[model samples]
Target: MEHRFDLLGSGWVSVECDPKSYRLSSGNQKRALAIRQLIDSAYNPIDWQLDFKSGYRWRADRLSGTLRYGHEPAVDVKVPWELARLHHLSWLAQSGDEKSIREFRNQVLDFAAANPPGYGVNWLCTMDVAIRAANIIIAYDLFISQGIEFDEAFLGEFHALIVAHGKHIMANLEWHDVHRANHYLADIVGLLFVAAYLPCTDESNAWLIFSVEQMINEVERQFTPDGANFEASTSYHRLSAEMVVYGTALVLGLPKDKKAILGGKNSFPDWYFERLERMAEFCVHVTKPNGRVAQIGDNDSGRFFKICPSFDEAGGTFKEQHLDHRSTVAAINGLFEREDFEEFSGPDVALDTTVVSALAGGQKITSYLKPGDNPGAMGVQITGGVDSGLSVLAQTFIEPVDATVLNGLTVFSYPDFGLFIWRSSRFFMSVRCGPVGQNGNGGHAHNDQLAIELNIDGEDWIADPGTYLYTPAPNDRNAYRSVHAHAAPKIGDKEPSRLDFGLFRLENNVDARCLCFSPDGFEGRHAGYGVPLHRHIEIQDGKIRITDLISGTKSSKVIPRIVKDGTSLRKLWSLDLRFSPGYGIRD
Candidate 1:
């Protein structure tokens, strides 16, 4: 087969190897099975179980269709369906199922016929277009690699689709002033993928340079020196980090001779890889024993690629299921050939060794963590040795810091991001006492300042009310970002930080500081609500205690909103409220 472009040298990529070599994890296989079943049943997996073909109006959870983007009803429907179709087809193509391949090809042709360039809801948001373009490229690559050939006309249409996507993204890139969040990152990644994988042309070359420059600049601007995503949202952190990984892989996977030609002046520097490694490590540190992360601020459950299934076997939604952070870490390990990262891999998470093996040469990849000299040297501080009785899951790649390192209460402070984690044998609590969002705009940030999430005995008790929707519904959007939605104290019905006019934007940057720290407790204060509000947290044995102190304001009524699951207002002396288990779900 003659190649039009060489993404990983002049050879043709193939998946005609042993199935075991590319096998996804059991959890991912379950998700793939679900997708396969949905396809076999002639049901679209992302219709939100609603009949879009009929006149049934689509609504975001309980939010009315009359709100926000409701004017363009198809905008919400197209993105998810496009994502589901691409993922379903990609999985089947990777598996080399002939019938599925035929179906996928037919679907691709059908979609192109139905939705022309810039005509459908799928093209409404440049971000969604970018996502679809990347997914199509990946699916097409997998299909060709599996020896499935398309007619020249089909190929022409596909290439034209790519061209249309590229022009759309270049013209409508999501660069709104200083609001460079995960959306902007995804746009550039899509452009880079299109630029690299497609045949070289003047426009493609220009896009390659422009995307590489923007990506490099965004990496430095969006992330702190400590590698924390400036948005302060764990879900967005993963999204942004994956974009970095994908961009890095695209560049590094190129032939050595073509490296200079592709990279040009905006070449990735040494610090870029180092920063990426640190970002992955940050994901590792923040992950809980149950394979879930702390939903610090707003969590929309956004993802870049879904090669492996992200579902758990119990049939829960995306938010109910745990995100496999280890998969991304494994890809990074394979990309950089860093044996040090092997400690972060485990059997429970899915591993795409095909992508890894293709990008990095065939190397023995293990799912077990091995002890090394100075294991703590990988960026995070470690102090304590493993206690024999601790569960294997509780034991992290970094050695458990000595209780004394906690100074007595096991507290880890990321001062750059103003994040503090306090842990005891039976409890874990995370406090967000930092600037409200990043880059002075807080584009992806919520208005939950000095909020906290608590976990007791591996069960989330007081938790963050996850972000329900973005931009589509105005009232629900504001409700989720309200002070009453978080586990924080509000003064006279006032928010600690001010929410800006745009979606997911917050202003009046809160000035917060950790005033005191000890082995048994932490003390912090913020002045975002026109008064100094202080919180003191103490954990002794299994008992948890929290105290709030407000100063500089008299006659100011303080209403504390403590969000907990499985409790009622009748049980406690407060008003009962519903919580969003995931994005677009409130219960």
Candidate 2:
């Protein structure tokens, strides 16, 4: 049987080292130790305990039910690949036992044998399935090397399943959407693994080659030019990079046309590396005073894998770079005793990393937006709403595409329904929508259209804690969308009346000056592409202040005046953003 080692990715490396002899060597020892330590520390002894505890009794019963009746095979019933890999691998690794491994081997073989190939979710969980399967393959390979019996039938079945799934994704998935970036990596790598181990028949070989080419093209097009913004969360971006780089590396390792894969030496721009640096920077900056990024979008659970080596070590190899890559690289290198490593840098993250709250006595609460959309979205918390700090909107806008919505905007939410999405509109009007729901449709249905923060010096308070956990459960959505999560008082109506804030950019296209308001200091500038114009305003006690500053080609400024009854919070609450005529492109 001819095995093709060319199932992995091949790319430019500034260093020369024997891939075969590579192990956790040199300064890498620290990284290896860190990896092991993380796993060990997180692996509670109770996790390995076979007996059920009082707290997990429900979960234990549910698992028992699944073991007994869940496999009846309803067409709608889906068993995630990750769960299977976890079960089989955990059973094997935890006990060093062959019983579970052997049983799982048989089960995988039997299922593959019975089911037709390439029949699964084409859109949903595509990358997820691939990663779980690859992890399982890795576990199986490890076990077999240890003299644990390997069943040819099982191995063949697993390989065939991979090929089928690969073909399924190639034929169906929309490769254009940048949101599918991570999924593309997982699928590509999974296919490469299958090609390496399975029989390289004409059909399988062709499929493998085609999948690799398509994936490379997708990465180049989606990540390089437009760049993956990963506005969702820092952790998700890391996860995204992991799936892609890991899979790409596996494929590159396979014997193939390296030049074609890498688009020739110096053909691609260095933006990917730049993006990685930016992402790493954001991770370093946005993490709470502690080291946690807000868990907003699709973040789940995982420790950062410092031991996992990628093209990043060479610095600028790939086309889609994350911001924090530089810092993470530095931290990882420092772990391994590399002199080139950077010093640890970042604010102290809050311990809760979930939600924080404060009370004064008045009706003032403040919740800062979470860092990332997916996982980082969860990191948002509130503190001293009516009590501690005056209501403040300290925002550092990072321009990129949100991971979930795949737009150049960041979203904020009050768990279930109270939500907000903001984007820098180069056009005359600033565009925004709010207080939405999390029902897998267009962004969300949050009723809070144009929400702004205000700090009031008072004795009474109410605050909104950003989020605790995720949804379906009553409080799950509340983590991102409860009224108590923000400093603003909930209107009598369950929903706010008008929710969209529009801002038309003025034509002058110049940086607007900051105007400070007393009683409460405030400064905000409209920052980004198109026409550069902004309105900085402030409020304290019963006093209201407004500042109009817009930098444009014509250099103009409108006199500051209250447009509505400043004393009435309701009428004055509206965000009025208008642009001088001819401040934008002619329609």
Task: Report the number of clashing residue pairs per model.
Answer: 7, 101
For each candidate, give its TM-score against the true structure: 0.75, 0.43
Q: Give the winner by lDDT.
A: 1
Query: Which candidate achieves the best TM-score against the true structure?
Result: 1
Global local distance difference test of model 1? 0.58
> Which regions of candidate 2 are displaced past 4 Å?
1-107, 110-125, 144-149, 176-189, 196-228, 255-281, 298-587
Worst 10 residues of 2 by lDDT: 352-361
Q: Model 1, residue 33: what's the lDDT?
A: 41
State, as a TM-score between 0 and 1, how close model 2 is to the true structure: 0.43
* Model 1 misplaced regions, further than 4 Å: 1-85, 256-258, 263-266, 315-324, 336-345, 353-357, 360-410, 423-426, 516-519, 553-576
**Predicted structure 2: lDDT:** 0.32
Q: Give the TM-score of candidate 1.
A: 0.75
True lDDT of residue 36, candidate 2: 31
Deviation in angstroms for 274 in model 1?
A: 1.9
